[model samples]
Target: MQADITVDTKGMACPMPIVKAKKALDNLEPGQIMEVVSTDKGSVNDFQAWVKQTNHELVHYVEENGVFTFYVKKQ
Candidate 1:
C-alpha cells in the first residue's frame, strides 16, 4: 500500500494540525491514505470529526511516546 503522507507535526496547535492534514489529503487521489503525527492532543478528535464531515475514512490511529499518529484515507 502507498500513502500520500505527512507526519510529525509537533509544536502545532489545534487547527494547524488539521489544516495541514486537510491540505495533504486534498492533494491525494481517492482511496489514498495520509498519516499525520501531531503533538496536539486535540488532533485526535479533530481528525475524527473531519473524516466524518468530509466523508473520508479514518483507517487507523495510535499514540506512542506522547505523539499522536492518525491514518486517514481520502474519499
Candidate 2:
C-alpha cells in the first residue's frame, strides 16, 4: 500500500493531474505504485477511466477533506 513515487497536483485540474501522473508514472518500473494527490473532484472519474484505457492498475483511492488521493500501480 505504499507508493514508489508521489506527485502533488493539489491545485491542478483535469488534464494537468493526469498529465503529471503520466509523466511521473513513466519513471516507475512495472508493479510500482504512484500516488497522485489532487483537489479536483473530476479526477476521481478521470483516473478511473485513464487506468482502464491503459495497462496500469488503479489500486485504491481515498478522499480526505477536499483532497483526493489516488494510488495507481504501473504495469
Candidate 3:
C-alpha cells in the first residue's frame, strides 16, 4: 500500500524499529499511513503488540526473504 511516509529499520534490532516507527508516525496526519521496513525478525511481534497499545491501525504486513514490511495508519 502507499504511505505518506516510510521508515526503514533494516539492520536495527529490538526497540529501534519501533522507535523509528513511533517517531515517523508522529510526523503523519491522523489518517495518513506509514510504512516500515525491518530486517529484525522480532519486529513482527513487536509491531503487532505496539499497534495494539497505540491509537494506530495496522493496515497490513508482509514478509519475504526475512524482511518484514508493515503498513500502519495513524489514528
Judged by lDDT, which candidate is best? Answer: 3
Clashing residue pairs for model 3: none
Worst 10 residues of 3 by lDDT: 41-50
For model 1, the local distance difference test gives 0.83
Candidate scoring better on TM-score of 1 and 2: 2
Ten-residue region with minimum lDDT total, candidate 2: 42-51
User: Model 2, 1-75: lDDT tens per residue?
Assistant: 688999999989888999999999989999899999999998788788998899788899889999999999999
RMSD (CA, Å), candidate 3 to true, equals 0.7
**Residue 57 lDDT, candidate 3, scale 0-100:** 91
TM-score of each: 0.88, 0.93, 0.95
Q: Please state every model's RMSD to the true fold in angstroms.
A: 1.5, 0.9, 0.7
Off by over 4 Å in 2: none
Best-to-worst ranking by TM-score: 3, 2, 1
Query: Which of candidates 2 and 3 reaches a greater TM-score?
Result: 3
For lDDT, candidate 2 versus 3, the one ahead is: 3
